[model samples]
Target: MTTLFKAPAKDKAALEEGAALSPRFDGSGLVTAVVADSHDNEILMLAHMNEEALRLTIETGIAHYWSRSRNSLWKKGETSGNLQMVDEIRFDCDQDAVLLKVRVGGADATCHTGRRSCFYRKVVTDGGQTRLEIDAEPRFDPTTVYTDH
Candidate 1:
């Protein structure tokens, strides 16, 4: 693949203030990616990106991520038709993380579970026990939408 990003600046000043985008990847060669809805700013999911995923996102204007669980690169919603069209991309001052504002297509879902967002559960404590409560409804049925699931 073609090289699209510069090597991270060694000096803190250049890294923080420079116009060049030099992402500081972690020891695992990945960077954190926070995705959100462009219109409402609803957080959709948290993902990771390797160099290639970042490059593809920039070039294609679509959100691409590194799947730590699958050990592979993933194009968001490629299978379920929930593609995330990136509206904007921003990096933290330290360049260790990225934020993608996007518009979701199809079912407007971002979670593999067919939910509108991956963060569909809320942590709650009841009777001294911690449990998860459903905060959002699924937009589509996973069994019907994703044959592989």
Candidate 2:
């Protein structure tokens, strides 16, 4: 694999407020990523990426993430049929976060629960209690798709 451009050391001006693509990874060597649909710009999910995952995403034009639960690099929708083809990748001013606009294929789903987006639930405060309400139904049956999980 080709080495990506090295991130410059944290310099207040360059790191926090610059136009350069000098990503500031956290102690775990990971950066936060927010993904959304390219057409509608609907938020899909939030993930993390390591150096390799970030490099691969830029090189391949496919969304890739570092799975904290699995502790490995994962191509989004590798298991399910909904692959995300990156259309545009943007970094925050601090370069500590990324935003991905992607066109999805197959089921056009992004959540592991077979939902179109991971943010399918809305937080509601009812009777002075916080709760989640499902706003969207599953696009596909996760029980049938994710048999292993």
Candidate 3:
């Protein structure tokens, strides 16, 4: 079953050109990566993707991200079953970045902390002390959510 979106071209030149023109990570031009939701409209996450990760994501139809923390490529939902199935990919005007719209299957929430989104927390200042406030609760628990899978 095809999702409702168009996949980006797989040309090497197009991919390189697009990634190069993407917004810089440290104020220097460098296209990292992008991810969206099933509808191909809502942006789900923004994480860096190396060449291997990009290739794997494209070839496998699943989201693969370069883990700056783990220093390796990570396949989304490998452990949690919050798999992000790639629906489509598109490039911005400058071809320096791309947007991946995906369909998340099973009980997996997008956030590593088990929230529906990675942006679940909001910073709030209480009595001059900066604190994190939970924007929402987890849609499902990582432990029991994907047991059937």
* Ranking according to TM-score, highest score first: 1, 2, 3
The model with the greatest TM-score is: 1
Question: What would the TM-scores of all predictions be?
Answer: 0.94, 0.93, 0.65
Evaluated at residue 97, the lDDT of candidate 3 is 72
Task: Give the distance in Å from residue 96's predicted Cα in candidate 2 to where it truly belongs.
Answer: 0.7
Error of 3 at 11 (Å): 17
- lDDT of each prediction vs. the true structure? 0.94, 0.89, 0.68
Which residue pairs overlap in candidate 1's backbone? none
lDDT (tens digit, per residue) of candidate 2 on 50-112: 999999999999889999999999998888878899999998877889999999987888898
**What is the TM-score of candidate 1?**
0.94
- lDDT of candidate 3 at residue 63, scale 0 to 100: 86
* Candidate 2 backbone collisions, by pair: none
Q: What is the lDDT ranking, best to worst? A: 1, 2, 3
Question: What's model 1's overall lDDT?
Answer: 0.94
Q: How many times do residue backbones clash in model 1?
A: 0
106-130: candidate 3 lDDT, tens digit per residue: 6646876677678777899988899
At residue 12, candidate 3 shows an lDDT of 59
Task: Please give the RMSD to the true structure for each candidate, in Å.
Answer: 1.2, 1.4, 7.7
Summarize candidate 1's per-residue lDDT along 1-149 as a digit string, tens digits: 99888999999999999999999989988999999999999999999999999999999999999999999999988889999999999999989999999999999999988898899999999999999999798999999887875
